[model samples]
Target: MNKYLRRALAPLAAATLGLTLLGGTDAVARPIGWTAAWAASPQRPSEGFTANWAEQGFSRQTLRQVVRVTQAGEQARIRLSNAYGTSPLRITGATIARAGKGAAVEQGSVRHLTFDGRRSTVIPARGHTASDPAQLTVGAEESVTVTLYLAETTGPATFHAQGFTDSYRADGDHRADVSGRAFGEKTQSWYYLAGVDVTGGARSERPGQGGVALFGDSITDGFGSTSGADRRYPDALADRIDRPVVNAGIGGNLVLNDSAWYGERGTARFERDVLDQPGITTAVVLEGLNDIGFYEAQAAGYDRPTYFPAPRVSAAELIAGYRSLIAQAHERGVRVVGATLLPLGGSDHYGAHAARVSDEVNEWIRTSGEFDAVADFDRLLADPADPERIAARYDSGDALHPNDAGYARMAAEVARVL
Candidate 1:
């Protein structure tokens, strides 16, 4: 066993063997409390900007990305993923430190991250690796910069396309650099890195202190929200709640079927994205918008036969999907909190039939009692004059996603239930 795992599992081993030191003093091991401090859902490289990343794989370069963590801790670990890679990924070195002004690390705060005591390791295709715990103190709402040096060519890297936060890239290896001088290029997506876990410390001792995971589509993904500011509804909700909040949303994602541009369907990824997250006691599901919107486009005869397939879905089918998600969460002892789909009346794909279906599904969410609780995002963001449309002030001009103000209101609504 790796040294870190052995250390982590020592308590379990001693308990299983019923052994104690010669003095008969019971050796009580300190429980290692892990909490999901930050996370970004991984997605396959698709067309447009993301495809460019797939083509230009990293070689002899350093990639430094900043992630804002919700839970504070005295020690932390980093998770790197090659979930969709076509070849092995080798990391020559890596460092984690408190983020400074821009693309820079705070002086005297940089710490080396190791894997089972090794400074470097190879991640096989479709696999992931987590670093050994590093002694780096961080406070809640602090941004941490993780720098990685790729010694080999990484082909078709698995990445989260819409990080909405700037990441820096520079030629040659600079994983140990403490300043931003080496970085020359900026990108707005997170590559390879998947999650940041922190030792729970005192927070773990509190009753019902487990984190909340927000699972949804673009709205939850912070599409219309301001970039680099973390203004998503989940972010706002996290600011209000004491427990950690992890955003598992993907832009253009669907609940039942996978789209080319979006990542996997919500049903397919629920276990890995939500159920597998450490310390997640509650899952707030807000999906089905794209599914309904696509079906509406097909009904309106706006779907291109070659590009877009004709979508057929009903309110019953959507409710069944929700029920499946709720049952899965319940099986894992995670409270399921359903969120009603927001209004999209002014969207280009909105149709009268789609509006009716949305109403039917929302009514089921509100009255079905299948979920432990419900967040009425639809009611909160809908226009008072026309219940079908979103309020003018809240709409992001796309009608599909919400503006920062709208997201704040959505967060306020979710806060009441959390």
Candidate 2:
């Protein structure tokens, strides 16, 4: 037997025995329901891979990260990604368990994760793989720690930078460790792992059994929120709604172009990040800030040439992009909730021209009648004294993203609309 399977048998046997003793037969139940409990948008490897990734290419290491599940389930599985890798990625072993404090896992709660009943699997370049379902029961609003052992030499790793939570790493294989002692280093980013799905019925079949995907930029990615606290607007919204709220926001993401540090453009990634999410019946779009800000900087005579080639866009062009997303979502029977662009007048990039453009876009988002519904984010964050600028209490000092209090307001606004 593989090393991973051998190490995992003890915990798996223990869990099974405990379940049997407790009269828990849900693991063997038929017609399993699968819903997304948590999700993160994957982006291409950063240019500063050597500094950011920490581990060297061809070296062996284990990565462990904790994520909060918005919906509970009887069984669970994880998705590993190599979406932007230049070479095949090999996973020697993987495991998931209930999180205990920092990097530790609750004793006896660990489960061995596999792919097609195999302990090890190789994912091809630009591909993603899902683990075979494991009998790991997770509850709503609970934290789960996932550990993966990368045993082969891989190219620049695909990762999400602004996780707003701490992830741990250690040398050699520690995928089955129940304690955080082996984890000697810490980072605030998620690598390889993408989505976590738990088996369950639809919302109509079972209460609190659906999902909402937040398609957005840095604001939605929890850029300024407290790390590891799950204070993002979507996180707050998840607490209010009956469905799981998945964060698909990539920091610095753009709608019209792929000029940001993260993955593909918003329009290009909607299918994989939103449409493909399990049990996602609704998607809230809070993008276009990056797209608008980039050009705004150029228009204000900021001479940073090599940053990004500014694309001249009109309010009409942005509306067309929103329309395409709406059409795609409608085709899949998914409701698209359009969010009005927030105030940006106080930021360095904002000028009279950019303000005019923002006004135009927000105007259409409120009155276009193109989206199934609208979340008036602009009205929620804008200062009444100076309608073009963010309220002083809501600004996160950058004049762009919102503070935690601001995120709470945004979440409350979404809840009202839902």
Candidate 3:
């Protein structure tokens, strides 16, 4: 018990510990990095695929996206979507492989994917399925190419980029059996692929995890980021942060309840859109203007357009809805950040009506103090003098969605808050 006696025994204890290290039977599991994760924003067609529209362009083709992995690990999952295609979207074959060498089909490793019941089958449109977690290994900062072989086409596709992006074109038709055709990668094009949901770590532990929930309209759904660009604001934010981003933005989604655009406002779907996320920690909301514009139109004397009219939501109503949304999110411990409505002054989609409603909503978002934080997408990309217009510099031609540069600006501004 004496200090000198204890000190004398310390070396014996230390030596024994070292000897145990050499012969001990105990083993520790390596930490596998697995943390909370979510997709940035999700998009589906306004209407699920129907037989009538099959002639237009309804069909399930191979949908793929490249996931850039930060640290190599041994387990992973794939979040496959049938969110927009009509009819059950079936997957004939799915695989994850290392990026191919060049224009050739490069194969590194392969894994089979399954649906609710079958390995090769269809997923109901507007529904989703996550592949069973698989055991595999990847390297630090490596890229995994997830490729899904397509079945027959039956409905119009709700692809990643609604606008335009550079894509490959084969000389002859190449949809039926694309087994050995040489492929091309357009470095500067936009891609319709949503995102890759992955899980990994060292040892038996999970990975360091964080996630982003992208809540907005079609823009957040990635309408205009360069095709294959993978540069939606949410994607941009996700790539910069050490977190998984899941996009919940649906085109034509409103903030207040409405019969049009899927029978309700974005709020109605929040439970499914925001709460249902696998592991969401941070969420960014960009809505309201749609409600204001659409509702206000009917209120005015504008006849229900056999064609259409401008948006008509009132400022007070939109603000109140936002308040409710904020309160609900806080209750769930999810940080809700507001996004100012972007300009649509020149959009042929809506006349001046939606633009005015947009102005009212943006004003409230900037001044209301109703959210945990605000992402001023309007200030970042709007025309300074007009305020109602997207800066000519940032407009994506139609003047509704932001161009690549415009998206970049929006992302940079949002990143500041995160």
Best by lDDT: 1
Locate the minimum summed-lDDT window of 10 residues in model 1: 11-20
* Candidate 2 per-residue C-alpha lDDT over 1-418 given as tens digits, one digit per residue, 9 for 90 to 100: 2223222211111111111122366445334445678998888776542235723433588889999998887778887778878788998999999999899999999998988779899988888877877888788889999999887767678888778888998899998898899998887888888888776423425543356889998899998888789999899898887777899998878888875365688888887888777667788999887777888787777775523787877778888889889988887778889999999987865876677878999899999798888999899999999988899999988888898899999998888876
- lDDT of all the models against the reference? 0.82, 0.79, 0.55
Which portions of model 1 show Cα errors greater than 4 Å?
A: 1-30, 50-52, 298-307
Q: Candidate 3 deviates by what RMSD?
A: 12.2
Q: On residues 259-335, what C-alpha lDDT tens digit does candidate 3 reach at each position? A: 33332367666654565444455678887645655444455545644113434457677787788778767766677
TM-score for each candidate, following the candidate numbering: 0.91, 0.89, 0.67
Query: Which ten residues in a row are the worst by lDDT in model 3?
Result: 11-20
**Candidate 2: where is the Cα deviation over 4 Å?**
1-30, 48-51, 54-58, 201-209, 299-306
Order the candidates by lDDT, highest first — what do you get? 1, 2, 3
Give candidate 2's TM-score: 0.89
Clashes of each: 0, 3, 60
Model 2 RMSD to the real structure? 6.8
